[model samples]
Target: MEITDLTPAELRVWRAFPLNEGVDLRESADDDPADGASWGPGRTVRAEVLRALLLDGPTTGGRVPGLKLTGARVTGRLDLMYGTVDPAMRLRSCHFEKPPNLYGAQVRALVLSDSVLPGLTAGTLRVGIVLRMTGCRVTGPVRLAGAQLSGALFLDGAVLGVPGARSGRPPGPEREDSGERPEPALQLNHATVGTDVWAVGLTAHGRVRMDGATVGGLVNLDDAELHDPDGLALEAETLSVGTDLRAARLRARGMVNLSGATIPRRLVLSSARLSTPAGQALRASVSTIGELWLRGTAPVQGAVNLRGAQLDLLEAAPEVWPERVRIDGLTYRRLSPHLPAERRLPLLEREETGHLPYAYEQLATAYRAAGDEVGARTVQLAKLRRHRRTLPPYARLWGYVQDVTVGYGFRPMRAAGWLLVLLLTGTLAFARERPRPLKADEAPDFNPVFYTLDLLLPIIGFGQEAAFAPRGVHQWLAYLLIVTGWILATTTAAGVTRALSRQ
Candidate 1:
C-alpha cells in the first residue's frame, strides 16, 4: 500500500521502521493532505518508514523477526510509544541525534541487545517492558521509573554520559507519606551499570539510588564503582535477593543505606570500601544480613551502624574474621571455633560499663551466658574486694576472712600457710601433755589449787566431764569457772584473729 492511502493508526506503526516491500513513498509524496498539519520533518519521514515495514511479512519465519537499525540516522524523533515486537530487536550503533520517545513501548522480548545510543539522546527512555540490554550504551540520562524488567537489565560495559541540561519545572513534590505510596516492588534508581548485571566490573558514576526497589534475584554489583554525594549508593528497602549480594570491591563514596532491607540469603560485601562520613557509612536497621562474610578489610569511615539488625555469623569461618564486621544487634547461633584468640577476647569482654559493682555484675552475667561459672565467680569475688571498705564492721571482717580462705582455694601456698598455723597449735598442746620432769621428792601439795590444776588438765583432755567431778561442796562453782574459761579463750582467739586481719 502507498503511504498516502494509509490511515493515522497505520502510519504510526509504519513510523517505527525503515522502507520495506509493497510500500511506495514516491507515489504518496506529491499530494499529501496532512502536509499542513503539525507534523515535524522527522516524524513524517519516520511514519512513512514504519508503514512500509508493517505491510511486509517476515522474510523467512512466521513470526516478526528481529529488527536491525544499525548505524541508521533518523532526522526526526522516533516514536515506538506502545509498539510490541514479537522477536528480539537491535538498534546497534544507531544515532537518534534527537530525543527518541519510547514512552510505553512493550518490546515483547529482548530489545537492543548490545546496541549503542551514542549521539542518540532521550528525554525519558521508558524501558518498563521486559527489555534486556546485555551491553548497551546511553549517552544521556535514561529513566525507567515504573518499568518492569523480567530478565537482567545488563548494562555490561555501558557508559551513560553526563545528563542533559535540566528543564524548567517545579521539583516534584516529595511524598510526605512515603510508606503510604508503596516503594517500587522493584526499583533500580539512578544506577549506572558499566558491565553486565553479573559483570565483574560494573561502575556507576552518577547517583545509583535503588531506594524502595525490590529485586527478586541477586543484585550483583561486584567490583562496581558507585559515586554519589548524598551517598545513597544502594537504598534498597525490603530487598530480597535469592542468592548472595556479591559486591566485592563495590566502592561507594556515599552511604550504602540498606535500612529496613531484608536479605533472606547472604549479603557478601567483602573488600567493599565505603568512604562516607563517620556516622553515615553503612546504615542497616532492623534488617538482616544473613551469613555476612566480610573477609578483607573494607575501611568504612562511617559507623557500620546495625542498630537493631540481626546478623547470622554461623557461616563466618574460624580461619579468619569476616572482611566486614556487623556491629548491630547481632545474634550468633555459634561462633567459629577457629576464630583468632585476639578477636574472641574483645567480644567476651564487652560488658556494660558503669558503677564498679554494676560493671562486675554485667561481667558475671556475660560469663554465665558463655557457660563459664568459674569466670563468673572470679568476677564476683573481685567486685567484693573492691567494695569491701563500704561494708559494715562485722561484714567487713567476715568478708576479709572469707577472701583469705575461700579466695585462697585456688592458691595452694596461702592455704598451706593457714594449715601450718593450725598444725603448730596442735603440736604445742600435745607436747605440754607429755609426762614432764617434776621433782618427785618435792611433790606438789594436795592443796585446793593443786586439785584444781589436776581437774583442769583432765577436762582439757576429755572435755568438761572431769571439771564436773564430785568435790567437797563447791564442786558446782568450780565446774562453772572451768567451763567459762574454755569458752572464753576459744571465742577470744577467734575474735582477735578476725579483728587483726581487718587492720
Candidate 2:
C-alpha cells in the first residue's frame, strides 16, 4: 500500500476518499465495464488500493474518511476477510475482476448497486447498517450463510448466477448434467436480518436459500423470477418473518418451500406463477401465518401443500386453486371473499390424496363460527358424500339412502317430512278396507286411525293391529305399511342419534 504504487485513477479515488466524495471514472453513462472490459489504468483501481483506503486512515488534512467510488474497474480480489471496516463503502456502477472475499468481516455499510462482479463470498459477515446490492449482475454464487445484518438487505433489480440465454431461465438439462452441483444464487441460510430483504425484479438462475433465516420486517419478492428447474427455486424452510412476505407476480420454475415457517402477519403470493410439473409448487406445511393471500389470476401448475398449517385467514380465489392440494392438517379460521360453503367446498375436494376429514371439519367450524349454521351443514354433508365414495358397494348404497333420507343426519327435518308422508299414506290405505278380527271375542273396535298408528309405531300397540286382518290386496297393503313403518322408525332413530352425537 505504498503511495508510489498508486495509479492516476487510484490516486484520484484515494484523494476523494478523505472528503467522502464519490469519484466517477466513466466518460459517459454508457461506458460499462461489463461490455468488453477495455477500461485502461485511468479508470482501473486495484482492489488492494480500495481495500487499504477503506481500512487505513486518510492521508494529510481531510474530512471524515469514506470509500465512495463509482464507475471504476476493480482489479484483483478485495480480500477483507476477518477485517473490521468502520467507514461506509459505496462502489456503484463498478466492475470487479474477482469476487470480494469479505468472509467474517464486520463492516458499517456496503453498497454495490449497479455493479458487475464475478460473485461475492461474505459468509458470516456482519454489517452494522444496510447492505445494498441493487441492480448488480453477479455471475457466481453470493453466499451469505449465517451473516447477520443490523439493517435491511436491498437486492432489487439484481441478476444473480449464470442465467439462461432464454428469458433468464435456468440452465438446460445438458448443463445440469455436467456433473457439478450448482450452488444457490443467493444463499442467506441461517442469516438474521434486523429489517427487510427487498428483492423485487430479481432474476436468480439457481436456488435462493433462506432456510432458518429470521427477518424482523417484511421480505418483498415482488416481480422476482427464480429459476432452478432441477430443484427448489426458493427454499425458506423454517424461516421466521416478523411481518409479511409479499411475492406478487413471482415466477418460480421449481418448488417454493416455506415449510415450518412462521409469518406473523401476511404471506401474499398473489399472481405468482409457480411450476414444478408433477411436483409440489408451494409447500408451506406446518407453518403459522396470519393471513395467506392466494387470490390472483395466475394458475399454479403443480400441487399446493398446506398440510399441518395454521392460518388465521386464507384468502384464495377459485381460479388460483391448483388441481391437486394437500390439506391434511391445515386449519384456517376464515376463508376469504365471504363465499358460501357450496362454492368453497370445491377447495376441500381438490385433495388428490386420501380423503382428509380434518379439512372439511375445519371448514365447517369456520362457517359455524361465522354464524352460518346452514353453510356448516352443507360442508358436513359434502364431507359425508366424499367419504361415501371410499366405501364398499353395499355401504355406498346405504350411504346414498342415508343421504337422501336425512342428508347423512345433517338434515333432521327431512326425516320428519318422510315420516309425515308415510303416516298419511298408511292412514288412507287401511281406512278404505278394514281388516277382519283375528279373535272375535277379544278383538277391539275397528278404528283405521288407531290401526295405522299401531302399525307405524313398532313399540306402541293400539290393540287394533291384533284385532284386524285384511284379505287379498288389503293384506298386502297392511304388510307394506308394516315394513314402511319399521324402516322409517329405524332410519329416524339412527339419524337423530347421529345428530345428537355430533353435538
Candidate 3:
C-alpha cells in the first residue's frame, strides 16, 4: 500500500517504515507525468499510522495522515470499521485491490470520485456531508444498507452491480428497449439521505434495492440502465422522497417496484423503458405522489400497476398508454395534456372492462372536477354496468332494464322518450276505436288526443275518460293504458330524482 501523496514532516515520520503500508495523505497533485514529471519513489502510509494521524492528530516527529490522497494506488483493504472519526477524506482516481470496509464508522465528508473498487461494504455508516462516488466502478455489490448521510450521495457515471461489467452505447432516437438479460446489483435499504441521490448515467447490472429508505431531496436517475429481467431491477418499497424521483430515459430490464412509497413532489418518468412481462413492469401500489408524468417520446413497454396510489396530477395520453396497465383506485386531481372530457375520456379507452369501482370513481372524479357532469355521469353509469357484468343473469337483466329506461337514473331523457311513445300509442288506440259517451248527451265534445293525455297522468286526471263509455275490449284497453302509464311515471320520477341528487 504505497501512499504516493504525502507532506514533508509526514514523509520523515513514515521514512522509517517499508512502503507496503496503505496510508492516508492529503496533498496537492503535483506529481503529474503530463507536467514533465517530478518524483521520488512512491510513498507508503500504513493503516495504524493513518489512524493515529486522523484520531490522535499531528506530532513533531510523528504525524497523523490528513486522509486525502489523489492518484494513489492502495494495496490492502482500507478498513475503517467500528471507528467514529470526523475528517474530510477525499480519494480521487485511486485504485484499490481490496474493498474498503467502513461499517459502523462515522465521517464528516467522503469522496471516492473517479476510482475503481472491487466492492464496498458500508453498512450502518454515517456520513455527515456528501458521500460522492462519481465516475467510479465497483465490480462487486456496493452495499449501503442502513447507512445515514446528512448530505447528498452521488453516483454520477458510476457502473455498479456485477464485477467487471460494462455498459453498451447510449440510447438512440429509436425506441430504448430493455430487450436483454440482467446481472446482480446494489442495495441501499433503510438508508437515510438528507439531500439528493444523484445517479445520472448509472449502469447497474443487477437489481438495486432501496426499500424503506428516506431521501430528503430528489433521487435523480436520469439515463440510468438497470438490467435484471428475471427479477426486480429496482425495489423501493415504503421509501420516502421529499422531492421528485426523476428517471427520465431510464432503461430497466425488470420490474421497478415503488410500492407504498411517498413522494411529496412529482415522479418524472418520461422516456423510461421498463419491461417485466411475467408480472408488472412498474408497481406503485398505495404510494402517494404529486404529479405523475408519463408523457414521453414513446409508449412504455410493460404494464404499470398503480393500485390504490394517490397522485395530484396525471400527465399522459390515454390513447398511447398500453392496455395492460392497471389503475384501480389510482386517484389523480387533474389530467395533463389538458384535453376536454370528450377527448380526455379516450385516455380510459384502452383500460380493461373489468376495472374496479374505485377505478371508475377516479375517472368520474376528474370529470366532475372539470365541470363535466355528463362525463362524470357516463363514467359512473359505465361503472355500474361493469359491476353488473360480474353479476348473475337476473341481476344483469334488471340492470339492462334500468339502463334502457333511465340509464340507471343517469339518462332521464330515455325515460321521457319512453313516456312519449306510450302516450302516442294510447292516443292512436283511442282515436281508432272511439268510445261512445255513456249517455247520448255526453257524446258531443269528445277529443281523443286530450283523452290520452289525461289517462297517462296516473297521479292526475282530466274529465275526458269519465265522459267515455267503454265496454268489453275497449274497457280492457283502458286498463292496459293506465298500467303502462303508471310504469312510465314511476320510472321517470325516480330518474329525475337521481339526476338532481347527482348534480
Per-candidate TM-score against the hidden true structure: 0.54, 0.91, 0.79
Give me the runs in candidate 2 sitting further than 4 Å from their true place.
59-62, 165-180, 390-397, 437-450, 459-463
lDDT of each: 0.47, 0.86, 0.73
Cα lDDT for residue 276, candidate 1 = 71
Best by TM-score: 2
Model 2: number of clashes?
Answer: 0
Q: lDDT tens digits, residues 1-503, model 1?
A: 56676455345434433322122222233322223233333233342353235324234434344454433333445556555534444544433444454544555443453444432221123333345544455444444544555555665555443332221121132111333222111125433222224534555544554655555566777777766544555666555555567777778776777877767677777777877764466767677767665666354666565555766553333323322334434443333333333334332233222124544555455555567666655665565676776788997886676566445132224434544444344334333343222444444332333334443332343222322233333445446445544533443445446435534
What digit string (tens of lDDT, one per residue) describes model 2 on residues 1-503? Answer: 78778888988888888888879988898876585267788888999998898889484564677888889989999999889998899999998998898888999999999999888888889999999999999988787888999999999999997765221212331121244556678889999999999999999998899999999999999999999856589999999998999999899999999999999999998888889877999999999999998877488888899999999999887778788999999989987877788888887778877788888889999998888999999998898899999999999998888888788878878877876776787778777777888998988778888787787778899888888788898778778778877766676777778778879
Q: How do the candidates rank by lDDT, highest first?
A: 2, 3, 1
**Candidate 2 residue-wise lDDT at 114:** 94
What does candidate 2 score in Cα RMSD to the true structure? 3.8
Best lDDT goes to which candidate?
2
Against the true structure, candidate 1 has what lDDT?
0.47
CA-only RMSD, every prediction: 14.0, 3.8, 7.6
**Model 1 steric clash total:** 19
Report the Cα lDDT for residue 84, model 3.
70
1 or 3: which has the higher TM-score? 3
